[model samples]
Structure formats: C-alpha cells, structure tokens
Target chain A: MKKFVQVEDVGMRFDTKKGPFVALRDVDLAIEKGEFIALIGHSGCGKSTLLNLIAGLTVPTDGVLICDGREIAGPGPEREVVFQNHSLLPWLTCFENVYLAVERVFGAKEGKPKLKLRTQEALALVGLTHAEQKYPHEISGGMKQRVGIARALSMQPKVLLMDEPFGALDALTRARLQDELMKICDATGATVVMVTHDVDEAVLLSDRIVMMTNGPAATIGEILKVELPRPRNRLELAHDPRYIDYRAAVLSFLYEKQAHHEKQAA
Target chain B: MSAITFEKALEAGAAAAVAEPAVVAVARSEPAASAASTASVASSAVPVARDGGAPSPKPESRAGEWLRAAARATLPPAIGLAVMIGIWYLATLSAGGSLPGPVQTWEAAVKLFADPFYSNGPNDQGIGWNVLSSLQRVGIGFGIAALIGIPLGFLLGRFATLSSMVNPIISLLRPVSPLAWLPIGLLVFKKADPAATWTIFICSIWPMIMNTAQGVTRVPSDYMNVARVLNLSEWKIFTKILFPAVLPYMLTGIRLSIGTAWLVIVAAEMLTGGVGIGFWVWDEWNNLKVEHIIIAIFVIGIVGLLLEQMLIAIAKRFSYE
Candidate 1:
C-alpha cells in the first residue's frame, strides 16, 4: 500500500535553558491512507511530539515529512488536530466553534448556508446538535471534547490528528466518544494519527499501534498490527480472545520492556 | 433561575442514573441537557451551571430565598456606609470645625444639584456642566489612549523583539505620576484644557498598552495551536482567536486606564482651572466652602465606582468561564 504520510528520520529538539533537549529522535513512520494509527508510550515518551510533527505544529530538526505527496510545510486545515484540551474558543458557541473550522475549510468553495449546514451536520455527527448555541464554559467536559472533535471533523481534513483526545474525559464519556469516533472514521474514511496512553483504547481503535520507548530521546519501539475487524464493539471485544491478545501485547510492551525505566526511576 | 434549578436536578439525577444503567442515563441526560440549554439561552444565564449542576432547592421558597439572598448581598455594604458616615460625623466633631459634617455637605449638595446645569459664565458653571466637562475630557483622552495603546499592545505581545525594545521605556515612564506630565503637556499645547486631556491620554495609555500586551502574550498555547492547525489567516486569527481571548485582559486594562484617567483628570483640572468638577471643587475651596468640596469628593467617588462597575459588567460579559 502507498504511504499517505511518510516521516523519514524525523527528529525534534528543543533548546532548553540547560541544554538541547531531544524529545524525538530518528522517528520513522509511514501511515497508509484511511488507516487509524495510535502512538502509545509512557509519560515523557514524546508520542504527542511526533503527532505535532505530523500535524506540522512543530518542525523536525532533521528529516522530511511528506503528506499527500507534498512536503509538510506548516500547520494547515488539511490536517485538522483535535487538541487534548478541546481548545474551543470559550467565547464561541458550539455551532460557532465548529463553524469556524468549517468556514475556513469549506467557505471558499461553498455558500454561507452550505457552510452552516456542514457545521450543523458535524455537530450532529458528534451527537451534539442540541448544544449548538452553548458556549464551551456552559457545556460538560465530554461535550466540549466532542465539540473539539466536531470542529476538526467539520474541516473535513485529509488527516485527523488527535492528541490524547479522550484522556481528560471520564471512562464512560471516553467509551462513548471512542464509539462515535469509530463511526465517524467509518463514515468519512479519515486517515487518523491519534496519541493514546490507554492500552485498551489503542487496541480497540487503531489499525496499528506504534509504541514508543521512553525519552530523553524517544523513538518508536515496535509497531503492532490490530487484526480485529472493524465495526468493532468495545463490549464484544472485552470478551474476544483476539482482542485480549492485542491488548496484552500492548500492555506487555509498555509494562514489561518499558519497566526498565520504571525501576531506574524507583 | 427555575430552569437552572431544573437542570441541576436533572444532572444530579443523571449522574446517579449513569452509575446504574447506561441506557437509562443516556435517555435521561439527553432531554435534561436540551431543556437546560433552552432555559439558559432564554434566561441569558443559568446560575447553577456552576457547582457541578447540583440539585436545586425546593421551589416554593424561591421568592423568600431571593429576598434572603438580596438582603445578604446588600446588608454589609449598607452597614459599612453607615459606619463610615458615623465616623465622618465623629471625626468632624473632633476636628474643631475645619471639616463640615455630613448633614452640612448633604444640604449643600441638595442646593447645588437643584440647578446643576446653570451657567453664570464658564468659570462659574453648575455642578452638572463641571461633571459633564470632566467626563468629556476623560472620554476623549481615554478613547485616544485605547486607539493607540491596544494596537501597540498587540504588537508588543506578538513580537518579542518589539516587547524587548519598549519594555525599558514603559518601565521607566509607567511609574511616574500622571500629573507630572501636565508640565510637558502645558508646555507643548500652551493651554490648560488640552494639557489636562494630554495628561489623561498619557496616563490612560500606559495601562491599556501594558494590559493588552500582557493579555496578548498570555494567550493560551492551546488557542494558538487551534489557529495553527486551522491554518487560519492572520486576520482571521486576530478576529477569531486573538481578540476574544484577550478581551478580558483588555477590559481589565480599560478599567485600570479609566481609573487612572479619572484620577488624573481631577488633579489636572485643579491645576488647569477648567469648567469641571475638579475645578469646581478648587473654586469652592477658594471660596472656603468646605461642604461643597466634600460634596465634590462624594461625587467623584460615586462616579468612579459607577465607572468601575460598568467596566466590570462588560468584562463579565466577555469572560467565558
């Protein structure tokens, strides 16, 4: 399969006051079109750093990142990111928040009403049609995150990049949003690169899980393919032997091999 | 408020319901959330949106509760004012009549306000004209300050180099008393009125510039990231993300600037001998009318409080959480 997003030896370094701090070094990953890939790692593992690099929120110190056969230059509407904090402008209503992204992406090609329709449709996709006029402050945490997702999706971006999208949400809201995300991906065929710490979540949602070793200079450790078929049910998977195998594999990589760092810290 | 209460009750019930059954919880929360949104939109605010949407109290005692809340809110300020008056009266008695008592000041205020807009030439105008003239100066000075300062702040906040360049200048000048600028103003303009306005403009500009810069720089990284990912235009970023995010801080700056401007205006007017409350107070002092001076002080205090409150209300409107 042709790679949709190709990261060739991507490296990220921040010049801290003390010295140069390498967050990600020589990280190579190729994501095929329509693939849902999760990057999992321990804390300080730079999973989000890689995702940011992919989103062009940050540039790599070395190596090339190509998206859709073009060099990734800077952040654009083509790669919409659902920020971890659900960074909806607090002043805007949910509909307006979604509309902002929709208008930016589709407004040039479509009329005002069509743009508005897209916003409403995006909100409806997230099961938040009723929350159209509510401000970010007025909504629940999960609802706010949903609006963030809605905003990203409303853009109809080629690549949907999420940075621990459901990390802040409660377990129930997390589960619900995951199901909604799966459905959205199915409907839109969005190529997604999501960062997650949860083993089950990565296993349950992604076509492949790219595990990263702990930083100082974090790099990809291993990539595990999730062979479980789509239209996946969390409950059904809870009892599936294959699901257990995938979940256990990720858990082992994170806890067993990565347990070396935990011991050193201890 | 009723709608807020209902929503609270519904959320509380919904949270408990979630623990038992997901299907039931979803069914319950969906309707409740919609009802809450409508109620909130209709009413403009739902107070119980805070506090984790706690179950509202029983509805029968609402009027009584409101009455109690109102009393609780208003009683302390009333008591404090009364105490202040009592102290003022006692202090006057102790001071051997240098200061007029509250009653004397109140009597003078009543007589003065009776024909407040009267004009017996520019220097001997009514209290209303004096107050209006002072407000006009503040308006002009403050308006110009905002026009210049806000944009400067945005630039300073946007660029580190500009901020660095101006930081020392701002720091050096910011601490100087606004009235001290009166000499430069008078020298430049060769007139009292324009000098007073210049003082106000200079003083008000600092707060607005400092605050706006502070607001712009302090914009959350998340919001900037949103702008980046959206690949919004510079204009769109300013309009959509930057402006709204910095609004609360801008209002703060405006509030502070106005406060300083109002303060500067009175002092400037005193020095300049203008047709304003500050000049009126000085004129009354020249005539040895201590009661009128006291009245002017009260008027200034009241006006400042009103201005602060108005700005506060505006700030509240823009604040999201």
Candidate 2:
C-alpha cells in the first residue's frame, strides 16, 4: 500500500525556562490512503503533538512531513483536525459551525447559499440533520463531538485528524458516536489518524493501533494491525479471540513501557 | 485496584460524602444521573431530525410572554421611578415635611414640560433644554473618546509588549479623578464647547480602553488557535474573528463609559457653569430650590439608567450564540 502521509524522522521540541523539552525524537511513520489509524498514549506522551505536526499546525524541529505527496508547510483544508475539545464556536449553531468551514473552503462566488447545501449534507452525514440550528452549548457532549467531526468532514480533507474527539463524552454516547464515525469512514473513505487513550475505542475504530512510549522523549513502541473485519461491533469484537490477543498485546506494550520508566526513575 | 472496586470506591465516596437527606437535596436540585439517562433515551426516541431543530422558546402564557417582553424592553429607571414615587408618597405622609408627594412631583414634572421652550431670563433654561445640552456634550465627548480609544485599545491588546509599555500610563491616568481632569481640561481646551466635553471624554475613555484591552486579551484561546491554524490574513482575522470576539466587552465598556460620562458630565457642567443637568442642579442649589434639585437628580438617574439599558440590549443581541 502506498503511503498517503509520511512523517520522515520528525522531531519536535518546546523551549521552556527550565530547559529544552523534547516531545518527539527522531520519529518516523507512514499512513496509507483510506486507513483508519489510532495513536494511543498517556498525556505528555506527545500523541497530540505528533498529530499537530502531521496536520501542519506546528512544524517539526527536525526532518519533514509530507501529506498527499506534498511537503506539509501549514494548516490547510486538506488536513482537517477535529480537536479534543470539539473547538466548536459557542456562538454558532451545529450547522453554522460546519457551514463556516465549508464557506471558508468553498463558498459561492455569488455569495449565494453554497455553504447551506454542504453544511446540510455534512450534518446529515453525521446523523445531525435535525441539530443544524442548535448551538454547541445546546447540544450533548457526544453531539458536540459529532459536530466537530462534521465540521472537519465538511472541509473535504484528504486526512482527517481527531485528537481524542470523544474523550470528554460519556461512555454510552462515545460508543454510539464511535459506531457512527465508523459508518462515516466507510462511506467517505477519508483516511483518519485519531489520538485516543481508550484501548477499546482504538481497537473498535482503527485498522491499526500505534502505541507510544511515555515521554521524556517518546517514540512509537509498537504498531499492531487489527485484522478484525469491517463493520466491527465493539461488544461483539470484545468477545472475539483475535481482539483478546490484540488487546493483550497493546496493553502489555503499554505496561512494559510503564515498568521501564519506573525502573529508570528509581 | 480492580476496576469493579474502583467503581465501588467512587460510588461509596460520593454516597458517604453526603448524608441521606442532603443526598436527596443534591438529587432534587440537580437532575439525577438516571434522569439524564432517561432523557437521553427519550431524546434518541425522537427522530434525529429534531436534534438540530430551531431552539425551543421558554414556555409562557400569551399574557405572561407579553409582560416579559415589556419588562425586558422597559427602562429600569422608569420602573425605579414608579417604585420610588410609591415609597415617597408613604414617606412624605410619615415624615410630614412641608415637601410635596408623588402627585406634587408629577405636577412639577408636567409644569416643566408645559412651556416647551427657553425661559426669558439668563440661567433659567427649562429642564428639557438643559438635558438636551448635556446630551449633546456627552455625545461629542464620547464620540471623540471612542474614535481615539477603541483603535488604541485594539493595538495595545494585540501586542503584549505594547500593552505592557502603555499599561503604566493608563494606570496613572485612570486613577486620577475625573473632577481633577475637569480643571485641566478647562485650562487646556480653554473653551466651554470642547473642553467640557473633553473632561467627559477623559473620564469615560479609561473604562472603554481598559475593558477593550481586557476583551482583546481574553479572547478565547481556542478561537485564537483556530484563527492561527486557518492562516487567516491579519485583516480578515481582525474584522471577522477579533472584532466580533471582542464586541461584547466593547459594549460593556461603552456602558461603563456612559455611566462615567454622565457622572463626569454633571461635574464638568458645574465647573464650566454651562447649560446641562449639572448646571441646572447647581443653579437651583444657588437659589435654594430644593425641589428643583431633587427633580434634576431624578432626571439624571433616569437618563443614566436608560443609556445603560440600551447598551445592555445591544450587547445581549450580539453576545448570544
């Protein structure tokens, strides 16, 4: 499979008064077209930092990132990110939030209602056709995350980046939205790189889960291909033998990394 | 801990923190988790079509709706005036002063409005004329301040270094009394026309400037990041994102400015000895007309309240999502 996005030995660092802190060090990864990849790590493991670099919201301190065969320079409509907080403008209704991105990316020259059609389509795609006029504050946490997804999808991006989009939501809502998101991915075939801490959510949603080590400077510990068939049911997949091994593998990788860090600290 | 024990510990901790009836109070005051679960179920039963539907208005009877609308639109001072008069009538009977009651005040208010023109003698302008003059001065001063302050505020706010540099100067000027500025303004402008207005401007601009800067600085980090991520042009960011984001604060500042303007306007008028509510009050005090002074005080309060309410209404419209 051809690489759709490439992170070529990318390294990122932040300057603080204390000293220079490395978030990611000499990390390289490739994501293929139409692939759903989950990157999981604890906070400060630079999962979001890596996602931001790939999205071109921040430049890597060393090396390069390429998206859709082009060197990434800055954020554009092609690499849309649905942030962890949902980042929905509180003032805009669900439809309007989606419409805003659509208008910015593809508004009519005549200023006629081009945004309305795309926004309506995006909301419908997210199963939020009726929630078009409701503000972010008016919606449930899960629904707001859905609106964030709709807003990102409305941009018609090549790579959709989700930064723990369902982390704030309740368990049931998160599960339901996860199901809807899978349906969205299957329909659109848009490649996704989602950052999550939930082992179940990652297992259920991704074609592969990339687990990262804890950071003083973090790197990918392992990438496990999830061979679970598509239209995967979370509860059903939990019962499957293959999923059980996959969960154990990911958990052990995380646990092994934790033990290594604790030994280092001691 | 095992996941089940973790769950149990959390539940037990919550339960033990509150006594039984106190737990009931918490449950009643806040809808229970079960209620939210039920609501979610009920919500899902509604077709997804209703999720993004137009927001439901607060339920109210037709008459009640009309009354709420009226109350929202009504001037607070007018409502305050009615209440004050009701209290005043009771007070007058109890105090048994030679002073008149609500009926007498109404009669006085009516007589002042009856002539509808300037008085023949010097320093004897009608209340209406005096109010208009005061308004004119406030308008000029406030207009000048807004023109100067808002742009400067935007600049100061957008640049942290610049704000730090200018902040000390602002602090220095802000605390100095508006009354102190009145004498300086009188000396500097050396004319009643602009100088009196300048006093109002200096006093009023402090709040507008500070609040506008605060508003600009306090624009949500998420929105700023969104603006940055989009790589929006500076002008586009200012007009579309920055301006709208800071609008509520600007309006709030304007309301505060108006109140300051009114406060300073009267003082300015008293010092300048020109035609305004403040001048009217001072002139009445000189003549020892206590009733006229009371009337002027009421007028100032009513006008100030109306101005603030109008600004509040405008702010509310733009601030709500």
lDDT for each residue of candidate 2 in A1-266, tens digit (9 for 90 to 100): 49999989988889999999998987889999999999997777899999999888889898999987899998888888888998887776887677767877786452647668888899988889988899888888888888889889988899999999999988889888999999999999999999999988888899999888888788887899999999898878878999999888888877775657846745
What is the DockQ for all candidates, taken in turn?
A: 0.62, 0.23
Kindly give the number of clashing pairs for every candidate: 0, 4
Q: Write the per-residue lDDT of candidate 2 for residues B1-321, one digit (tens) a residue.
A: 122222233244335434454344333322332333334333443443243332445423443454445444543433343334434544554567656655565566678768746776657888888999999999999998999888888988999999999999998889888878766776887787677898888988988888899999999887876665555668767876789889999998889999999988888898788778888899988887667777788899999999989998899888855
Query: Which model scores highest in DockQ?
Result: 1
- Residue B246, model 2: lDDT of 91
Q: lDDT of model 2 at residue A167?
A: 90
lDDT value for candidate 1? 0.87
Residue B71 C-alpha lDDT in model 2: 44
Task: Give the clashing residue pairs of candidate 1, or none.
Answer: none
Using TM-score as the measure, the top candidate is 1
What local lDDT score does residue B306 receive in model 2, on the 0 to 100 scale? Answer: 94
